[model samples]
Target chain A: MKQIVSPGCTTGPFFPVDFSDGSEDLSQRNGLAAKGQHIILTGHVLELGGKPARNMVVEIWQADASGIFRHPLDPRQQDCDPGFWCWGRARTDADGVYRFTTIIPGAYEDRAPHINVAILGIGLTRPLVTNIFFDARADVVFECVPAELRSRLLAKPEGDGVYRFDVILRGENETPFFVE
Target chain B: MMDDSTMKIDYAPYDDATQTLRQIDKYTPSATRVPSAPLIERPLTLSERTGPTELVSKWNVGKLDLCRLAPDSPRALGQLIHVTGRVTDEDGAPVSSVVMEIWQANASGKYIHELDDHRAPLDPNFTGQGRLVTDEDGRYEVFTVKPGAYPVLYSGWWWRPPHIHFSILGTSWMNRFITQIFFPGEVLNEKDLLLNGVPSRDVRDRLIFKPTDTVMGDLSYIGYQRDFVLRGHRQTPELP
Candidate 1:
C-alpha cells in the first residue's frame, strides 16, 4: 500500500520574525497609540489529539475602531484611524499559546465586530481561515452558525478588555472553520 | 415521496469487496480528515467583502533587501543572489500589488530570532527577513545571500534543506496561502520530510528554484527564477 500523507500540511515550519513596524501590535502604529479601546486577545492552539500545537503562525486582520479598512479598494478608507496597525501576527509558544494586542474592531454595515484569522504551519495542508467575534454582539452572527458550533466562535471577555478564544484544529470539539 | 424501489440501499457495506473499497476514502485529504470545516454556503456579507485589507503601507522602508538591517552595518557574507519570480493565478492571470513576506536562516544556518536556539554563530549583518509587493506585471525580486542548511532536531538528526518561507496575501481572505521555496539540485531535497509531504511529484517540482545565468555587472551575483501559481481556477485537463 502507498503511504498517504496528511492534507494541507504542504508548507513549512515558518518562523515569522518582525519584518516591519506594527507587525505584532495592532493597537499601535510603530509605538504610537491607536484609536480604540485597547484589548489583548489570547488563546491556545491544540491538535485533534488534544496536544499543544507549537510554532504555528497565527495572523489577525481587522478594521479600525471607526469601522473602516486601510485598503485601497475600501471606499470607507477615509474613516480609517491613522494610528491603528489593523494587523498583527504571533507564533504559538511551546504550549501552543498565541496573543495579540489590538483594539475591539468596530462593527461594519450588517456584520458584527470581528477579527479575521489565518493559521499556517506544518500540520495544516492549507491555510485555515476563521473569525473571532466579540461576545458583545455575537448573537447577531451566532444565529447564522449551527447551534452546536456557535459557542466556538465567540470570544469571552475577561476583565480589562481582555478576551480569550482557544482554537481546536480537530477532534470532537473542533473550532468552527469557514470555507473560502 | 414513498418510492421505495428508487431509493438507494446500503447493501454494499455487507459485501467484503465493497468494504475494502470504502477504506480508500481515508487516504484522501478532505474536511473529514483535515481540521478545515466545510464552508457554510451563504452570500457574502459587507464585513466579509470590504474588510481585511492590506495593512502594511506601500512606502514601507527597506522592503527588498533581506541581508542587512541597517545601512551602517557590514554586509552579510555569502554568495550574493537575486531571487525573482512572478505571482499569477491558476488561469495564468497576473496577480498584482499582493504582499509577499519572505524569511529564512543565514548562510551559517543560524536565525536572528530569539526562539532559534541553534548553537551556530549568529551573523550580526544578516537580519533574515524581507517583504515586497508584486508590480503591475505580477513580478517581484529580492536580493539576499544563499542560506545554509540547518538541523531540525524534531525530524531526526538530518539537516533541513536551505529554503525560504513565503507568506502571500492576495486580494481576498480566501486567496491567502503560504509555501516554501527551495534551491534546485540540493542533495537533501530527497531526504527532507516537509518537502516530501507534498505527495505529488509534479506539485513538489513546482516548489524548487532553478539557477539562471543572468548576471549583474561585475558583482557576479547568482540569479534564481521561481514563479508562483496561486489558487484561483482548476487545473486544465491534460490532453491524452
Candidate 2:
C-alpha cells in the first residue's frame, strides 16, 4: 500500500481563486501594449489513463522580449520590460483545458524560447515542473530525449500567433516533466 | 581500489529488525495514500532558471492585511494570532529575502473564494490571504486569526484539521515548496490522513506550530513560530 498521498491532493481539493487579476493577458500591462508578438497558448491536462484532469491549477512564468525576468534574484544585466507581466495562473475547466494569452518569450543565454509551467491539483503530490518550447527551438532542449518523444514538449504554432500544447499527466506519450 | 582494506568505512547492513522498523517508518495505507505517478527528471536550462519573476506589486496592490482586509474594520472575526517564522537552507543557514504566498479559510471555516459554498458564515472583513518577504535574518511575521475546521465529503464525511496553505518560491525552480501548517495540540492531528501522509514522525512534527505568548501593546496575540528549511542536505521533506 502507498504510504503517502501527493502534496497537493493531501489537502483535499483546492479551488484556487484567480489571483492573477488581469495579468493572464500578457500582451498588455496596465492597459498599455507590451513589446512582443502576442500569442495564445492552449492545452488540456490529462490523467495517465487519458481522462480529463479537471480543476487543476496551471501557472506559467517566463522572461520578457528582452530576456529579462522581473524577479529580484535574476542577476542578468538585461533590462526588464515594464509593460510585461511575466507571470500568469489559471484553472482547468470541466474539459481539463487551460489557456493563456501571452507573448513569445525571448531567448535567455544559450537556450531558446520556452515557457516554464507548474501544475497542481487534488491528485498531484507536488507541482509538476515542465517546459514548452517551439518546434524550431525544440532541439536545444530535447537533445537527450528520443526523437519520438520530443514532440511531447513542442508547442506547434496554429496560425496567427497561437500555439497548441497539450499536457498529458500520465500513461503512454505522457508529457515530459522536470525536477529541480 | 587503491587500498580498500586500509580505508575505514561505516556501514549498517539490512536485517530483519531494520526491515521491520523500515516498514513501520514508511508505512502509509493505500486508503490514505496518494498514489505514485510518473515524472520526468531533467536539469534546468538557462531559460527555466530565469523564467520565474516576482509578483511583488500584484501581491502588495491592495491593503496588505491577512487579519483585516477592510481598512475601515478595526478587527477581523475570531481570535487574533501572530505567525512568525524563518526561511533557511537544509544546513540551517538563513535564506534571506524569499517570497512567500499564503491563504487560508476564514475563522468560520469558509474561504473567501466563490467556489467555497459551505454552510459556514463568511467573515466579510477577512480575506485569509497575504504575502510575506523574509527579512535579512530570514524572519517573517503575519497577523491572522485561527481558522475553523471544516468538513469535506470524503468517506461519507470527514472534517479537516485547521491548516494554512503556504507557497514558497526559492532562488531556483528546484526550491519551490508548497505545504500546510497545522496548529499543535489539535486532537484531530492524529486522525488527519493528510498530516499522516508524512512518513517520518520527527519530520511530521516539524509541520505543527506551538502556541507562544506574544503581546502587542495592550492587545495580546497568540504567537506561533515555524521555520522553513529550503533545499539542501537536510532539506525539509515535501508532502509525498
| Displacement of the residue A76 alpha carbon in candidate 1, Å | 2.4
Per-residue accuracy of model 2 over A1-180 as CA lDDT, tens digit each? 111111222223554454545546767766677788889999888875677777777878888887777754455524778778787887778898988999888876666777888887665545677788875554355665556777788898889888999888766677777543
Q: Quick one: best TM-score, which candidate?
A: 2
lDDT of 2 by residue, B1-240 (tens): 112221121111111221111112222322122223434445455455433435544555332468775656767789889888887754555656666777888888888766565789977788687777777787778888988988764444557788888777665555566778899988888877667665567657767886778787876788988877655232234569
Regions of candidate 1 where Cα sits further than 4 Å from its true position = A1-11, A29-37, A135-144, B1-43, B50-54, B68-74, B214-217, B232-240
Clashing pairs in 2: A3-B28, A5-B34, A6-A125, A7-A125, A48-A170
Candidate lDDT (C-alpha), each: 0.67, 0.66
**TM-scores of the candidates in the order shown:** 0.77, 0.80
CAPRI class of candidate 1? incorrect
The TM-score of chain B in candidate 2 is 0.75
The iRMS of model 1 comes to: 12.7
- lDDT of model 1 at position A166: 90
iRMS, all models: 12.7, 10.9
